[model samples]
Target: MDRITALRARRAGIIEQMEAIVASVGENEDLTAEQQSQFDALRAEDDRVAAQLSQAEDLERRRAAAARPAAPLPGVTAPVAGQPAVPAQPAEKGLTFARMCRTIAAAGGIPHVAAQIAEANGDGGLFANQNMGSGPAGGFLVPEDVSTEVIELLRPASVVTAMGPRMVPMPNGNLTTNRRATGANFSYTGEQTDIDATGYTYGQVKLSAKKLAGIVPISNDLLRASSTAVDRMVRDDVLADAAQIQDRFFLRGSGTDFAPKGLRWQALGTPFATTHIMTMTATPDLQKVTNDLGRMELALGNANLPYTGAHWTMSPRTAMYLTNLRDGNGNLAFPEMQDGQLRRKPVHVTTEIPDNLGGGTESEIMLVLPQHVLVGEHMGIEIAMSTEAAYKDSSGTMQAAFSRDETLLRMIMQHDIGLRHLAAVSVLTGVTWGAA
Candidate 1:
């Protein structure tokens, strides 16, 4: 049996033993010392077992809750909570040229032509057609299922998305929700007297969608050969571009020129206060690391926040430095690093966190409560294909139309990030690798 069951059985056995001892004593007679001692010890064991059982049950319940997905927000359906909603699955079929044509037709919003194009292109007619170009006759919309699969593949690769923030769906361009600015105060009052009003401090967290787009070119020959290959290629290319950009901006982007307000900047603002910012006294060593974490715990405790679900985020370089530190006896200072957790909390490493030292060149370690971070995403990705359009290069220079011979598949994604509670985040700055 599981731990909970075992504990219950042990508690029940203790109770049975206590009852038998009690029954042996007469109603008017007190128990002998030996008998009383035995009964007392059994009762104590019973209490201890009961406490353990309670704790085990609580943990079990939390595990169950975490495994279940969050409920859908009222009146919203397309974008579910926590993760983007994927479109319904299409019927299963073997990978073939006809299948590719059908997907393209559905995505192009002409589902009626799926069967006809599939039949004609079963042996590769669509990609070989001479009329194929950027016009309506050439381009097809990617089917809903295909687009959904790409998104599913992208979710795991995104650091911000994998962190499990409070996902809010953006039905429109923006969303706003009230947050607790201050908690209610309690005071003792005389009977039959009116009580003073305990005002509640409140603030708002507003999220506005920011658009991110990327373009990928596909070879005409590859598009006709295997649908599976094309699907994987498109998914990987789009995800590679989007994940890096999203991770960088979501962690440190300044709220300017349509960019989302990032976590780093938001944590430095109001309600978080200077106390939330912990600085190491010296270079990163076991003593300093312990001290810094203690301060962070104290800050969170003073703010009346629980450490549950809190985690640390830093650069992989910083993690490597910490994990490599040796004690005076040459033993590893942080053996727990091997398990990817510190102080029983998870550690997330991302390159987005810089590793420069002192004078604003310092690397940062963050203690984050995921529930306080809000992420909003538009329902689905918008895709468009073009062959003749001249696209601007990454350097902001325009490329000549003649230089582009492949079809450019443009993907647009909209999302936003906000902090529901600033106190739920803490940062440690000026952290360096070793002794200066």
Candidate 2:
């Protein structure tokens, strides 16, 4: 075996042996001297193996990096005599606010330039006065690199983005795409027979942009702290909240008011209809789950939907219960559950799927082909700051005027979600774990 594989195998063996040694000693009993010595020796060996594995992995990574060709620098030319040589691009590094600003500026966007101008002018733009660093008001814009780092730190882990849906950049107010329900057919003819008209149905799905915004209040003191520190804190908080709201609406939104129509709601409409909804038997157990999954597969097969890249989505509680279930032979009912999958399909666990539905305690489990899900997002986020503002109180029942010492930051993002094909999603409703 290769060095890395051999090291990993050795580590696994050591871990197994350690587990055996621990099990040999009764729960309430102490290990004998010999046993203790053996344990210590095994631990030391394990540590050595782990260190070697880490080194091997690092070496492999370096080798891979060295093997790849360097990317050509754009807009960079050979240096002339008397002029300093243009520096080669540096290695990939973590995100920073300064870098973010430069990138934004490079894109010819207004936000990055505005931030820089605000910082330089000391006009109290996007950042607080103190965070602007030792600078006259006229040169206050945070460094592009610093802004890049801050933006990187604020990025939120996105489930919708992870699913790899078809992303359409909606620059206009609305986007419309024609979807074909059927295709034209051709057949071989012996003679010059009259051609028959092929029947095909087409429909359009219109996705209109919906706005999601969050307002954050920060004390002047906190805002005046290190711009990096304050930017990190505020950006993370706002983006995280926005990501959660987006994910929730993308999965279960009813498309009311400002919310986008999500997968669950779209599956209930025409083209998909209720045929994709599968109801479990009286007792919802592991066997029933497996059976329902089989039924779903069959339904999709009959509908001629490809099963590749399909995934299962359910609540964490349901997943935990299913993973812990044992068969009649005391073997794991679903051995692959440890990998967060079912029947070789990836499983996504999210609380967005409500547990209280049909029976007030029923949860939904769905099989979805992410490629059929269409998601649209506006490219950039807009951020504005206000020192004098009226904000909603904690209860949201009353408006409170901001104190002179406080500042309010408002962030706005726009996006929408829709399905290209309803049959590509099938849901199992009224599912419950354990005994009926």
Q: Can you write out model 1's per-residue Cα lDDT over 113-190, one digit (the tens) per residue?
A: 333344344533332332222335335434445545556666667766677788788989789999888988889999
Candidate 2 on 1-436: residue-level lDDT in tens? Answer: 1666567667767888998999998889999999899999999999999999899989988998889655558986645669977699873333233323322222223333444444443432334322322222112344445433433433324555556778787888578997767767877766788887787678777888888666666566655454555555655655566666667888788898688987777767475565788787766666776788887776666667786678787887788878888888899988798997788888887777777777677888778887888877653455445555678755885444345565555555677887777777787777776423
lDDT agreement of model 2 with the native: 0.66
- lDDT for each candidate structure: 0.69, 0.66
Give the runs in model 2 whose Cα sits over 4 Å from its true position: 1-156, 186-195, 216-224, 227-231, 386-408, 434-436
Off by over 4 Å in 1: 1-149, 192-194, 217-224, 357-361, 387-407, 434-436
**TM value for model 2:** 0.61
TM-score for each candidate, following the candidate numbering = 0.64, 0.61
- Winning candidate number (TM-score): 1
State residue 435's C-alpha deviation in candidate 1, in Å: 10
